[model samples]
Target: MPRYLFLKHYRTGQTPHPNAADRWTPQEISDHMAFMDAMIEDLKANGQFVGAEALSPRGTFVRYGGEGKPPVTDGPFAETKDLIAGWMAVDVESEEEAYAKAAYLSSAPGYGGRPLYEWIEVRPFLSEADTPDLG
Candidate 1:
């Protein structure tokens, strides 16, 4: 079984299923998270889940000069052209399985209990024979 990484990118030029995030009520948000938790539990029970996590929207990019020099951060890095919201790693038997999981995740509940239709990037880990430059 090979491992695949599913990346969830933050906001972009694309439009959300519902119009805006603020449209979602508190209970709707809770319900959405509950759905995600249930999916994780189900995946675990089936022995197909490896791990999953989300990243904070805000982060600092650091540049180090030397051991004695402190890292520096510029405010512009707060939001870049592409912000990766989060990701999920899964060890599956086939590419179809990975795509299936991605599709399922994309169907997560959104405002008014509709699907989010989030785009997930599915990438496979490079095997020893796949990477020629690593050596």
Candidate 2:
């Protein structure tokens, strides 16, 4: 079995949805959340749902200040352009299955029963057991 990550990226200050979530009707928002919940449940049922998570848009970049100093941060730099909205890591039997799942995720609902065709980056995890020794 191999694991893969479905990276879902979002543009900061860029509208992912023509009608942003905040602008959606309360019922529309609820429906959107419900859709996500159902998707997760479906994945779990298939035993391919390893994990998923969402990231906050407001986060800062931290770096070491100096040898004797503390960490330093310029501020919430990720807010400037792009953001990794969230990701779903799954353990599946094949690459095609992973790709299928990624494709399925792209059809999430947006406004008025319309589909949000967001682009997803699908990548596989390196399986140490499957790798050949160089030496």
User: Which candidate's TM-score is highest?
Assistant: 1
Q: Lowest summed lDDT over 10 consecutive residues: which window, candidate 2?
A: 11-20
For model 1, residues 10-41, the per-residue Cα lDDT tens digits are 66565433424458899888887797789889
Per-residue CA lDDT of model 2 for 1-135, tens digit only, reads: 789999876643455546444466778867867887898999899887889887766667789999999889876474534557788999888999999989888777767767767778898988887799998
RMSD of each: 3.0, 3.0
- Which has the greatest lDDT? 1
Listed in order, each prediction's TM-score against the native is 0.78, 0.77
lDDT to native, each model: 0.78, 0.77
Deviation of model 2 at 46, angstroms: 1.5
Cα distance off (Å), candidate 2, residue 30: 1.6
For model 1, the superposed segments whose C-alpha errors exceed 4 Å read: 14-23, 64-77, 133-135
